[model samples]
Target: MADLHRQNEHGSRNRTRFPTQPTPSAPAPELRGHGLRLRPWDAECDTDVETWLRGNSDPEFRRWNTPVKLVDGMEDARESLRLRAEWDAEGKCVSYCVTDAATGAPLGHIGVNDIDHFIRTARVGYWVLPEARGHGVATRALRLAARWAFTNLGTHRLELGHALGHDASCRIAERCGFLYEGTLRGAMFDAGRHDAFRDVHLHARLATDPEPGEGEGKGE
Candidate 1:
């Protein structure tokens, strides 16, 4: 297990505070899987990241990403990087940029937000570049993050939420071994419509569950 308190030398950079959110910090355990690396969000990767997101932000990819307004330039990525740093510093959340191991290209982003350490739980979210979708990049990155969380952060369980109509995300949650907990009725608002939140299936895996191993049995 990697040390949660230890900061990587590469991640050391000044960060600005979000008005209501804590600053982000380095992720624990420095996870890697499926030809991808998940590391703490850093400012140095700004150019690579902006390019990735710019090319990946399509209507197909943004349908479920209602919470994050799409940015039009590199400054937005810079601000997000700063917020990630603050979140890490305050331990309020942890975020990572998914990158290709061979080419070092930023593929997407994922994170555990709204974390409550005392409860040993957190919500997981992710987005893969449009071209990178259907390649298991999101699943690989998510499982790696969960492994780090449980093994290093003392998390007993992990939770995920997807909009009711997003069947793809639901499938990913199931494949990852998260049990469907239940739905929150009328709990979601998207695109100016108040939609009935699909029974937000709450799938969870214990720390002791068998590791599925990278890319093994992953759905296409």
Candidate 2:
């Protein structure tokens, strides 16, 4: 698993500050899916943001994703928001709060990382809140973001990878039309932060690929 807490592809440490909510003159761009919405992280989302951080801090999330430097939940949430803002402003990444389309409740987060304009490629990652699990939130959010990346953001290819044991993430990637590429040996966090690397499975979707509908299995 890639480090969800890190900001840049180069693995450099940086800090970000929360910015004021977008005004009416510059409302945040909205990305919609069948029953989901992806919007820029806003001030009101700190709680959900903290949830995401603390969720990933546990052994369950850490086992499959890159280990995060654990900190106080609220403190990490504040810093995560600022780091996300910095990533966006630096053109390093674009992240969004995944929400319920009708109720306007945040369910999770999804984003593109390690973006390289010259290559027109980026890596896609996401996490679903516990309550959102089994609702197909992650697959929908991922597909929505991938479509926007290819059609609107000039991304030619989007990469998705997960720890070899993360069946759910692999399923979500496949359902979103990412083709299985191969396994990367020792490519992820093993146990603790900076622990030995674990193997990872790589998948990717090209702009020319056809979209897969719901229920699609891991490999077509």
Candidate 3:
């Protein structure tokens, strides 16, 4: 299972065939709700490049996530965003730059990745910037992205995994109605180390699961 996860593909006995209707609806619509707007990451935009670099290079974010190709500097950040945009173009993932709905300032990142429409499942991950910590930015972004995934991608299941001790992320998952599923041993690279591995606490939410309460703003 861990190996399959690493490949970004899920194996299922169901053998069901779902139409390739291009999940994520292509071009990735802006998801606005609850004082947050999730827009696609743009490599050509300077603001996107700076925020992408800052967020991805942040100590706190690196403590949890290690991209397959590390963003080492400004050019790397632009390339990273370029890859995200390309992945979305290929309908393999939908990445978003989470920002304040009113101010349009980048506050974090959230992505519904490895979308398998036939299996109707995808993985989700997020990080809150230092300035945005303790303000529920991650929670809000997760909910908005989840809602968008289910609606636009027809995604039946969304999976979230965090390092075993990431209690804050676990709580955010729970708050968004993603119930604890199980632990995947050595499912991810250990914090700041590509050579070591760490266990991941898995959580999942079904399309039919009860929705989280609507908070401050209406969905768009």
lDDT of each: 0.67, 0.74, 0.85
Per-residue lDDT for 85-196 in model 1, tens only?
A: 7777788778787888888877778888777664466788888776677777877787888877777776777888777777777777777767677776655556423442
lDDT tens digits, residues 1-220, model 3? 5686654455565655666535444688899987899998889999899898999899878888877888878899999998888888888888899999999988989998988866688999888788888778988999899988887678999999999998888888888889998999999998878899999999999999999775523211
Instruction: State which candidate, 1 or 2, has the greater TM-score.
Output: 2
TM-score of each: 0.75, 0.80, 0.87
Candidate 2 per-residue C-alpha lDDT over 1-220 given as tens digits, one digit per residue, 9 for 90 to 100? 2464343445434633323222223433789867888988864466666766755665565666664665447767667777767777677788788988999887888888887774578999888776667778888888888888887677888999898878888778777889899999988777665757888899999999987876633321
Model 3's TM-score against the true structure: 0.87
Stronger candidate by TM-score (2 vs 3): 3
Once fitted onto the true fold, the runs of candidate 2 whose alpha carbons sit more than 4 angstroms away are 1-28, 43-45, 214-220
Better of 1 and 3 by lDDT: 3
Model 3: lowest-lDDT 10 consecutive positions: 211-220
Best by lDDT: 3
